[model samples]
Target: MELIQVSHNEMAALFTRPSHIYNSVGFALLNAPKADSVEFLTFRDTRLRGGLILGMCGAMARSPFSAPFGGLLLTREQTAGAVEDMYLLAAQFAAGRGMALRVTLPPPFIGPGLYAKSVNVLQRLSGGCATVEINYHVDLRGVTDPVELYSRSAREKLRQARSHDCRFERLETTPEAIARVYDVIHRNRLHRGFPHNMALEQIVATSAVVPMDLFMLTVDGTPAAAAQVHRLNHEMAQVVYWGDLPEAQYARPMNLLPLEIYKYYLAHTPVRILDIGHSTDGGIINRGLCDYKESVGCRATPKPTFTVNLRREI
Candidate 1:
């Protein structure tokens, strides 16, 4: 088996279409923006094996991250043994440089066997690394009806929007509209008590990998709300980097935007599932965020976040 470092475009192609989480695309997107330097390692036992595209930093030290790197895409056949290849390759790649291997995987609570093996391999490679995971999935083959898929509250929100003359329009990602979308997401994060780490440069870089569209809910001519639509391998549509303008809050465009996007995917795109991305945990520990998502039509599904201590060294 041989491990090789692929170029940004190659890694982007591998990740932009594969079944792995969108974070992979985010990595390539943020690689140049956040980090002073970047390297993309692609493992190949036969096809693309397993490896990480990490940023260049000093002494493999841990730094606060806005999001995790993407999950490695490995076929069921190549899952085993291939992990060792990745570890050794990454180590060598960071050799002399003394950098830690930090991999962030976003998988469903119930992932394929290869997924579990990945965690086991990462543990074997690193001694210590910060980790976190958010569980969200795409049901590509089932659940396409927006109305049927929506919970009662979600349906009601759409109805309410129509009653209020809230109009929905899907826009293409263009330079002119980029800042507008960013402003909405920026304001939303502020309202939700989170910072906007997804800078414009990263957003533009990331959008270059996969096909992207913008969904907007408008009042008259101004943009009230928007969500970036990432078309994933024709199977799923990822609702990523969303935000609502302050005025949108009063207009309740948050509730309306999702339904419009859902309906658009159902009618125009070949997407079978839509991943709403991050949600607060429900169960004994309930959060308003999770509650809000649930009210709009999300059900609690099993998801996991993992961490590895780099000092441990697999």
Candidate 2:
């Protein structure tokens, strides 16, 4: 097999079906300005296998230019051997260009076999993993009400949230509405002493291209909590950002917000799982925050980031 650089249009077409939004065309546009440059490279011989659109940072080629994690996206059904060869050839390309390789992959549930093989191959090439973060997701298959799996503590919090007159509605993803919701997220982040990494304009621009939805939890007709959801693919969705208003914390809208989100995916779309995003800062686990997610029917998966010096033996 050979590693070849393909046109942007060709890469876009192959990644069109059931691929992560972070690697899609919309994200490519958003990712371009953030990087020095970007390129599309894939493995090809008789047929095109898997590849990645990397954003260049000096001599380092990073897979995810925008979101949490994205490495090699498979374009067709291929074997484990083929997957390993793709990674090997990708490293060769990087070495030829005098570049390094840095790829971070999402949770394995997105593609079980592919992710497993990727992790093994990346580890072998790099000699070890770079970092691993705990990512949370709510499994939605073969279920209706998400509360059935919630812990008693979480259930009580949901009950308290329900005692107040609350409403959950999916907002129209207009630029104005996105800014309004983003302000709430910004406020919550500030209150909690966390940096807001993404800007309002990026979300608005991405919403125009990808399938983005806004959902809100209103108590007594007042906004208490809101969440920005992104459909990673037809089968998976992610809660990009979600938080409760500072004053609304007394109502525990955070609990109810996630529950409503789970039901929305179960009832409204082809999606079978809802990624709750990460509760980690770097590789450090936020125990308190992560425990709370588990209480609300979420499971943790190790999302790994791999790095290799292409100039070395790899």
Q: State each model's CA lDDT, in order.
A: 0.61, 0.84
Give the least accurate 10-residue stretch of model 1, judged by summed lDDT.
60-69
Best TM-score among the predictions, by candidate number: 2
Query: What does candidate 2's lDDT look like per residue over 51-91, in tens digits?
Result: 78788888888888667888777766678899889888877
Candidate 1 residues 48-136, lDDT tens each? 66556666655542222334325555434464677656665666556536565555554443245656666677666654343333444
| TM per candidate | 0.76, 0.96
Total clashing residue pairs per candidate? 21, 0
Model 2 / residue 25 / CA error / Å? 2.8
Candidate 1: C-alpha lDDT: 0.61
lDDT of 1 at 178: 71
Q: Model 1: runs farther than 4 Å from truth?
A: 1-30, 42-48, 61-68, 88-96, 109-111, 123-130, 137-140, 220-222, 280-286, 299-314
